[model samples]
Target: MPRGPPAIEKPQLEAKKGKKEEPKKQVKKHVKKQVQPEIKPEAAHGESNKDRRKQVQKQTDELFASLDKEFPVNQMGPEPKQGPKTPATPTLMSSSSRPMIRNPPPFNAVVAGTAASNTAPTACRSAPSPPFPQPAPIAPAPAPAAAGQRDDEKRWDEQRWDDKRWDDQRWDDKRWDDKRWDDKRWDNRRWNDQTWKRSRVQDWRWKEEFERKQKEMDEVLAKALAREDAAAKMAQQERLAAEAHACMSQQAAMREEVAAQRAQQERLAAEAHACVSKQAAVQAARCLAWTQQCATVSREHEQQQQQQSDAPKMQQQSKSAPKSAGNWKHKNKPQPKNCHTNPGQNMRDGRRFKEIMQKNESLKAACKEAEGRAAEAEAKNKELQERVAKTAELMKKECKSGKDTLEKLMKQHEECKKELKERIQKLEARKKDLKERISALEAQNAKMKEALTNEQKEAEEQKAVKEKVHRNEDEQKKAAKRQKTEGPAKK
Candidate 1:
């Protein structure tokens, strides 16, 4: 690879040295320019000086070319050298070090490369090697023979291997068949063995004891189950009974309600009938009273007509009597002379007196008859007034009774409405209470079911454990019996 430029310490030092020298030279030139005087030279001297200036410029160019060759052209300038200790130029750094222009590695490429490198060692450490060399199998020790014990031990091992093989085969078969395995037959086989019989005899005794205990437990369970069943039945029966009772009560209530309604209806009907009858009676009484009034008015009118007719007749009689009086007056007027000597004059005076007395008696009789008719009419008018007054009094009494009954009916209707509202509220409250009780009972039932499930699981687990222990004891006993039988034969 091409190495980066060798660290140019000398170039940097020269550039720094030039920067210091340039400032000193500038100071010296400024002093010289200040000290030197400006002078006007002749044309010939000016031309000679121009040639001299050209010669000096040529020499200066040669010197500059030599310096340019020795150091770079850029090094000739009085620019400051960059160093670690030096403060960076703000403009140069800002322009050259723009963040946006820099090229960076792609994120995925960098990550993938890093991950490849990082995982290399881990792969080497974790990778499996080719199959390892097998370890030497350990040789089993030769078992010391205890006469016939050797055969028994061999038989026991062979039987154990057979049992293990059978168990493995059975497990595999069950898996292959997709069938459920039952321990019941295994448990029964263990239970039927000779050692298991002795152990079971002991266990049977223990089991008899346990059975006694279990019997007690079963009795207790049965009793508890019976109690629960009885309780459930009783509760069901109670509920049924209660429902029946409620139905009966409802029936009774309905009957009572019907009866009450019928009674109320009858009462209303009776009241309606009574009101109708009262109205009819009142109407009848009013009609009768009106008829009576009309009859009384007709009778009074008839009596007035009769009185008018009699008055007209009396007036005619009075007029006739007055005419006779006028005739008597005219005849008496022409007989005035020799009144004491005439017998005829005395007879005329006697006749005139007799007629005047008769006329006065007739007038008195007519006056008495008119007085009697007026008295009869006055009595009839008074009777009609009494009848009218009695009818008005009866009507007022009937109106007062109707108003009182209407007020009473309004009050009863309001009371009935209030009672019905109260009953509805009570029924709603009872319904809420019953709903709460039902919710509580449901929650209790859920808890009981959970407890029953847990208890059943525990009982099954205990049964499995007991069966395993019984099998182990039977196997041990069979091994012992086999050893004993083989020992005598070996001897």
Candidate 2:
């Protein structure tokens, strides 16, 4: 018999001499009432095992209440406490004598009903015989002095007890088989529980690891992005610097070229000025020489005019009966000494006149030559003066052009300076912006590094938690395996 709560006995149908018909009706009515209420609508509708268990519990509770009321157990007092004594009842009608349905009826009885019916008869046959009846109520004892008969009797008694024990052992073996099946089911449930718990722990650990890895990857990507941005900004700045340097070099070269041009213009002007001064000096010297020569010619001409006047007067007096010639003839040749004296005197006078005329003609030719030279000199001087004025005007124009060019160059230089200043300011502003950006990037990078570190720490903690969970799961599995291996051996 299974070791558990005693069964509820159903009273045997025994006919009463006085009210057999009425008692049958009453018993049938009572059976119908009990059966109708026991088959609950909610229990029949239940789907899950838990719901079915609840239904079974409700039924068991009802049965237990009914049994407890029908056969209440008396209280026993504690030690040193006096309790009232009650009359002793016969043990013949105890829970052990109840008709027990050994194999519990299934909640869904339809499926198990046939099998239950088939096994019920067998179970009844295997049950112990009632205590009221005995096959041999009296047995004659063999004399103690007769050894052979006594030994025979004793052997027969022992054989009978052995057969009874064998029957009881067979019944006990069947009950043990049933209990072993239930134990196997309980063990399967426990193993499933352990597997579920371990799987849940593993799933949670995997989830944490996945999250940590994802976070780490995000941080790495962000750092890479920040680095790329910084590199690009630096490259841009380098390119700008190269451009600015190129511009400055170009400006310096242009300024050098402008300076060289201004110097060249100044040198040309200086050379032109020198040539004008040299020409002017030569013209002045020519004019002075021509004036002196003209003065000398005028003085000589006046002297010749005075001499001509005296010669004419002398000729007139000689023609008339020249006082000097007459007087000289008288004084030198006494009174008349021939006309030879007059002839000789006339010849000498003619020769002197011819010489004077030759001298005058020569002087006139020289004066005409001097006047022509003077006129030529004056023309050359005027031409020189005109050339000098033209040169001066050209120089003035050149100077004016140079001044304009210089002014233009100066304006350009100022403009270049202004542009350079603007460019410098722009570059400075850009540098400031880049510096601020770099600082911001640095701060952001630091924060990212810090966040990455924090994530690493968290990941490490998760790994530790996962390891601990794995260890616990391993231990639980080991214990479960040990229990499984030991269970049958213990049984």
Candidate 3:
């Protein structure tokens, strides 16, 4: 098997955590021993100088041949060695994280070896540090491999000039420059993509969760608003019902009052009419009796005068006087009183009659006024009765119209024209039919839902049965597959 050049194992560094002093001492010691190996004197064995030269020549030839195969002559720099890569994710830190400063390992803690030794840690040639977090800059470990070559140099003094060319640190610097080792160090794009993919899921989940919470809140608010609206509607309905009851009671009271007023007015008018008629009859009777008495007294006085004036003529016409007496009439006072035998009695009676006549006149005037008042009262009472009847009819019509729907009230309003009202009425009828249809449909839907629930239950039972059969089939298939793959004995 082909293998890389063998390397001498160097001393390991013991850098304690949170410590610097101890590692510094160990590193110093390590550097001293590794850089300067002990030189020992050898006994002279008579080996030929030509044989040593031949061996040196052969090693040189092999080194050149290996170099030619690894690199073309055009590429002046050696190809950078690749180490086992670590994922960039391990070095990542959160944005809120503070930069951490740690104590670096002591310089030269690791040992240096030749390019052929694969285990050696490669040193970055550049002094500039990377922007991102990385391992601390490690100083190159000292190389003590030149001990064997040094012995060769001491033994063969002629080889000093050639040995010095290879021994100088400048040659090592040129071979291991910064640019050569920096190629394909880290992939920034891959780290960025991984970070974006990782955070995207969390961002989407948070967004969806926020939206769901908002929807729930909105639904809760909607339900609260609906409850408030329902409560308000209930209160309004109660108020309207109370008002209607009060209005009905008031109307009933008004009807009773109107009937009572009409009855009282009719009774008063009848009483007034009867009283006026009775008074007029009494006045007529008194006036007629007074006129008759006056007429009788005047007739008697005329007869006595005729008899006294002509005693011989009256005795001759006395038989005829009885016949003419029946035709005798007398003029009289408006309201006469009986005259007594004395003139003073006559004057007194006249004065009494005059007072009586004056009283009769006043009574007639009063009767006339009373009749006028009665007529006025009757007219007023008739007007009130008509008014009450009209009011009752108006109230009845209003009560009847009150039972009408909102559409009727809208029809009466001036804002709604006849054409619009007709259209509205037609639409209302259609809406009523639609409502009826919807109610019927809803009833049917409820029945259907019940039936659907039964069907769904049956379907679920069938699905369960089907799933069981499928499970059995799958189990059998799995058993067959298992038996075919692992053999039946394995189970």
lDDT of 1 by residue, 66-134 (tens): 756875645434322211211111111122111111211112232233222221111001111111112
Q: Global lDDT for candidate 3? A: 0.43
Question: Model 1 misses residue 417 by how many Å?
Answer: 2.5
TM-score: the better of candidates 2 and 3: 3
Which ten-residue region of model 1 has the weakest summed lDDT? Answer: 22-31
Model 1 earns a TM-score of: 0.26
TM-scores, all candidates, are 0.26, 0.32, 0.34
- Model 2: per-residue Cα lDDT over 1-491, one tens digit each: 11111222221212211121211110011111112242322111122223544464476568657745764544211211112211111112123222122222111222123222212211111122222111222234433534544544454344334332332332233333222332343344545654664575466457546755775676576557656755765565565556556655655565565566556555655555554555555555655555565555455445454555556675676577645654875446443222233446546655765665665566556555656655565565566556656655665665566556556655655665575567557656765775675577557556654654665465466446545634654464355445434533553
- Tens digits of per-residue lDDT, candidate 3, 151-215, equal 43243332322332222222222222211222112122324543553465356446556755775
RMSD to true structure for each model, in Å = 42.6, 23.0, 24.3
Q: Comparing candidate 1 with candidate 2, which one achieves the higher TM-score?
A: 2
> How big is the positional error of residue 159 in model 1, measured in Å on the Cα after superposition?
30
Overall lDDT per candidate, in order of appearance? 0.42, 0.43, 0.43
Name the better of 1 and 2 by lDDT. 2
The segments of candidate 1 whose C-alpha lies over 4 angstroms from its true place after superposition are 1-371, 479-491
Checking candidate 3 for backbone clashes, the offending pairs are none
